[model samples]
Target: MDMKLSGATFRRAASTVTVIGGSGFIGRNLHRALRSVGARPHVFTRRKPFAHAGRVHPAVAKSDTIFYVAGSVTPALAERNPELVEEDHWNLNLLLWGLRETGHRPLVVLASSGGTVYDPDAAPPYREDSPTRPVAAYGAAKLAQEHALAAADWTTPVILRFANVYGPGQTASAGYGVIPHWIRAVHARETLTMIGASRRDYVHIDDATAALLAVRAHADRLRATPGPTTLNIGSGAPTSLDELHRHLERAVGGPVEVRREPARSFDRTDTWLDVSAAGAALGWSPAIGLAEGLAGTLAATRHTSMSP
Candidate 1:
C-alpha cells in the first residue's frame, strides 16, 4: 500500500541475497523491496537459474542470504495430487543439496504457510510452540520443508510462517489467494462465491515485506535465540468470510452477488496467528488495517486491468 521501506533505510548484512522463486507473488515483492534498499538479490527461477553461472553447482555461490519462497501448488491441488506434492518435496531437497554443494553458509529464510501448518482443532491465535497437524498436502510440504532446512546444519535457518498474505501483485488463478481472487471477480462485475464460513488473518504485502526485512536485519539475534525459532506473520485480527465480502463491496463501490457453497475438507475455520513472537523477536507488527489494505488492493487491481 505504501513504499516498503518508507524513508527509514538501514544497512543490509548481506551484499547479495538469493531468492529461489523470485518471480512469484511474495518473492517479487521482496525482491523489489531489497532493491529499494540497495541490496543485490540474485533471483533463481526454473528458466533462468543458471544462466549466468553456466551450471547449477555454482548458482548459489557468493550469496549471503537465501530466501526460499518457491512452491509447486496450492493446498487443494496438493490434496488432490499427493504424487506431485511428494515430487515437490524431492525437488526442494535437491535444491538444498545443491546449496550445500556450493559450500555457501547463508542465512536461509524459508517462507512457511501459517494458514495450513497447524491443527484445525487448535484454538485461535496459534503460537510458535503450537502443534502442527497439517490436514492438507500443502501444509505437510511446508512443515517438511522446514524440517529439511533444519537438518542442514551448515546454514542458519529462519522460518516465517506467513498468514493469508494478499496485495496488488497477487492473482486469483490456481485455486488459491482468495482475497485477490475475490477482488478480481468483483473488478469483473462477477458473482463472488463463498465456500463455507471461515475466518483468516490477513497481512498486507507491505507488512509482509517489512517482516522479511526485519528477519534479515536481525538474523544474528534470531540465530542466538534458544530453540528452533519460527515466527507467525499475521495481522492478529481475524476477519470472517462475510466480513471480507463487506470489505470487498466497499472497495468495489457496489454489492457483489454471493453464491454460498459447502465448505471443502481442506479449509480451516477461525484460524489466526499470535503475532507476539514476531513483535518480540523482530520488532515488527502489522500497521495496515483490513479496510485500508482491501482498498489498496482494489485500486491496484483496477490499475492493472486498465494497463496496456
Candidate 2:
C-alpha cells in the first residue's frame, strides 16, 4: 500500500475541484495534498458556509469533482443536541439543490462513518452491503446523507464509509476524535477514560487521503457505471482501548493512568470494516500500521507542545 501518486496522475484526474468543509482534520490534509499535486482546489469552510449566493454556488457549479466533508456533530454531541443533526441534513440538501439548479454533474465523494453505521449485532469487519442499523444520532444522520446522495441522479456519488481516522494535526476537543483526546490526556498526566471496552479500526490520515485521491483519479470509471458507488475505507484491523493505552505508554516511556466508565446506551461495543472492495476498486489499502502511526502522532504532539 504505497499511497503515493505522481503530479501527472492528479492532473489527469481533474483540473478543478471543490472541497466543502476544508478546515476540518481530513479536509485540511486532502486540500493540501491536492494542491501539492498540482490540482486546483476551491475550499469552503464553516466560517463561510456554502450557500446559493456569492462564490460558493459558482464554485460548486463548475467543479470537475466535489468532496463533501462538511460535518458539525460527533456521536456525543449528536446525542446531547439532536437539533444539530437536522441542521446538518439541511445543509446537504442545499448543496444538492445547487448542483441540480446548475445542471452540474460532477463526481461527488462523501465522507461517511463506518464505525457507527453498521449493525452492532451483525459480527465485525462489516462490508459496504452490510446491514446498517445505527444506534446513535450521528450514524443515523450519515446514513440519511448517504440515502440523499443515492437518490440524487443528477450527480455522480461515491460514498466512502470511513473508519475512525486519526493522525497529526488532529487536536483534542470535546466531542472529537478519541485518539487525540487520549493523547492529550497522556501528555497532561491525566487519567485516560475507557468506556465499555470499545474496539475500533483506526486508519491513519495519510491512508485516508490516498483513498480520496484514488477515487478522484478513477472518477470517470465510477461515473460511467449506473447508480452510486459505495465503498469502505479503513485498515481492516481492530484495536482495543487497552491495547491503545499500552501503545501510548510505550511511546511516552511511562505508565498512563486509566479510569473506567460504563458504556453509553448509544455506543457500539466493537466495530471494524472490510476494506477489500476499496483495494480492488481503487487499488488502495492502508499502509500505516497502528503502532507506527501512533508513534508518529505522539512525536508530532510533543513538537507542537514545545513550539513557541
Candidate 3:
C-alpha cells in the first residue's frame, strides 16, 4: 500500500500545538517531539506556570494543533471516585469544544488506552475492526471522550491507541507503568510481585513517538479521510511475565525476586495489538522490541544517574 501526504488531506501551517495534560508522562515526551519538529508546542498544565510561562498556559484558542494525552489510570480511583472521571470528561469536552469554537483546525491527537480499550478475549492480536468492550472504568471514559472528539470537529482528529508506554523518567510508585515500576524495584533492590503473566506488546517510547509523528507528517490524508483515525503502537509480540522477568534479570543482572499473585480480574493473560493497519496506513512500524527498548531505557537512566 502507498501512503502519501499531499492534496486535500494536508492542511497548511497549523503551528502552535496546544497539549492538554502536558504534565503527564506521555505528554512530556510528545511535547519534546513536537518541538523537535519545529512545531511551537503550548503545554497547558493545571499548575501555576513556570519556564515559558507566557506560552505555557495559553487560553484554549484554536490555533495550530492539539495533542490530548491527559487522563487518570487505576481502576480503583475510577471506581471509588466516579465524580473525578466525570469531571475529567467534562473538562476534556469543554477544552475540545473551545478549540472547535475557534477557527483553529488542529490535528488533535488523543492518547487512548490500548490495554483496556478492547475486551480481553476480543480476538487475539486485536485489529482496529475488533469490537471494543472496555472492562475498566478508565477505558470506558476514554471511549466516551473519543466519541466526543469525533463529534466535535475542528480540523483533523487522530486517536492513538497506545499500548503500555514504558521508559525512563517515570515514577513507578504512582502505580501506572508496569515496566517503570518493575525497573524501579530492581534498581532499589526490592522484591517484585506481578499480577499476571507478563505477556504484552510493549512498544518503546521512541517507536511510539515516531509513529505519532508520522501521523502528524501525514495529517492531510488523515484529515481528508472521513471519520477519526485510530492506530495501535506496539511491538506486536506478547512478552509474557515469565519472559519479562528473565529478560530484565539478564539486562540488569540484579536481585529481581518475584512472587506470583492473583491476577486482577481486569487483567488479561495475554494481549497485543495487530499493527498491520498502522503499517499499511501510516507507513509506521515499531522499531524497538521489549528487550531492546528496556536496554536503551536502562542505559539512558543509568547515564543520567552517573552524570556529574
Candidate 4:
C-alpha cells in the first residue's frame, strides 16, 4: 500500500490532543511524538494507576483528540486480580459520559489487543473482522472496552487492535513486557526462561506511534462519521520464543541460556495480525523491522540505564 501523509497535515490535524495514560509505555512515546508534531497534548493520569478508577477531571472535556491508553498491565496482572480489569471499563465509560454531558466530541483512539481478541484455535493472521473469543481475562476486558466504545454514541472511535508492542520505556519486571524483560536479563546475565514456543506478532513503538499520529491527523473525518472503525496494528510477522531469544542474544552481544518450561494452557501457540486495513485506511505501514527495532530498543535501554 502507498503510505503517504505530510508532516504539516499531521500538525494541522493534531491541534488539541489528550492522552489518558500519558505516563504509560506507549503513551509516553506517543505524547513525545505528538509534541514534536506541534500538537498540544493534555495528559490525564493518576500517580497510582492500578489503585482504582481515577476520576477523569472535567478539564479534559475540551480536547479535540483523545487517546485512551490508561489501563493496567492486564495481560498478566488482570487474571490474578479480576477487579482491576473493570477499572478500565468503568473509567472509560465514565469518561465518555462526562465528555458527552459536557458537549465534547473528541476523536477517541482506543488501544485494543490484536494478540488476545481473536480465538487462537481459528487462524494465524487474525483480521479486524475475526471472531473475538478472548481466552484471558485481559483479552476479555479489552473486548468489553471495545463494546463500551461502540456504545458511546457521542464521539467517533478508532479502535487499534495492537500486537505485542515493544520498545523503549517498556517495564522489565512486570511479568509482561517480554522484550524488555529479556533485555534486562541479558544485561544482568540472568537465565532466560523459555516458557513456550508460542509465536507473537511484535510491533515496534515507532511504528505504533506513527500509526497513532496518522489516526490523529484524520481525527476530524473519523469523528464526523458515526460508527467506530477498527484496525489491526502489527508487523504481520510471527516470532517464536526461540527466535526472540536469538534476536536478544544478538542485540546484547552475548549468549543466553534458555531454560525450557511447560507452556501455559491459556497461551496461544501461534498468532499474527493482518494490518492491511490500517494500510488502506490510514496510509501507514510499519517501517521498522524487528532486527532494527531490537537494536534501537537495546540502545535506548542502555542510554536510560547509563543516565544519571
Q: Which candidate is the best by lDDT?
A: 2
Clashes of each: 0, 0, 5, 0
lDDT for model 4, please: 0.81
Best by TM-score: 2
- The alpha-carbon RMSD values of the candidates against the true structure, listed in the order shown, are 2.6, 1.9, 4.4, 3.0
Q: For residues 192-293, what per-residue lDDT tens digits would candidate 4 score against the true structure?
A: 777878889999998998899888776656766669999999998889888888888787787778788888766777889999999988888899899889
Task: Give one digit per residue, the lDDT tens place, for model 1 in 155-176.
Answer: 7788899999999889787766
Which ranking of candidates, highest lDDT first? 2, 1, 4, 3
Question: Which of candidates 1 and 2 reaches a greater lDDT?
Answer: 2
Report how far residue 123 has shifted in candidate 1, in Å.
Answer: 0.7
* TM-score of each predicted structure versus truth: 0.92, 0.95, 0.87, 0.92
The TM-score between candidate 4 and the true structure equals 0.92
lDDT of each residue in 1-308, candidate 3, tens digit only: 12333332234325455677778777778778776655666777667331132232344464555677777655557766788889778766766655655555667788787777787766668877778888878778888878888887665778888888888776675557678877777666778878766478788777787776677767767877887888887888888888888888878965479878887655656678888888988888887778877877777777776789
Q: Sort every candidate by TM-score, greatest first.
A: 2, 1, 4, 3
In candidate 3, what residue range of length 10 has the lowest lDDT sum?
A: 48-57
lDDT tens digits, residue span 193-288, model 2? 988788889999999999998888887788898999999999999999899888888888888888999988878888999999999988888999
Model 3: residues with Cα > 4 Å off, grouped in runs: 1-14, 48-60, 305-308
lDDT on C-alpha atoms for all candidate structures:
0.81, 0.87, 0.72, 0.81
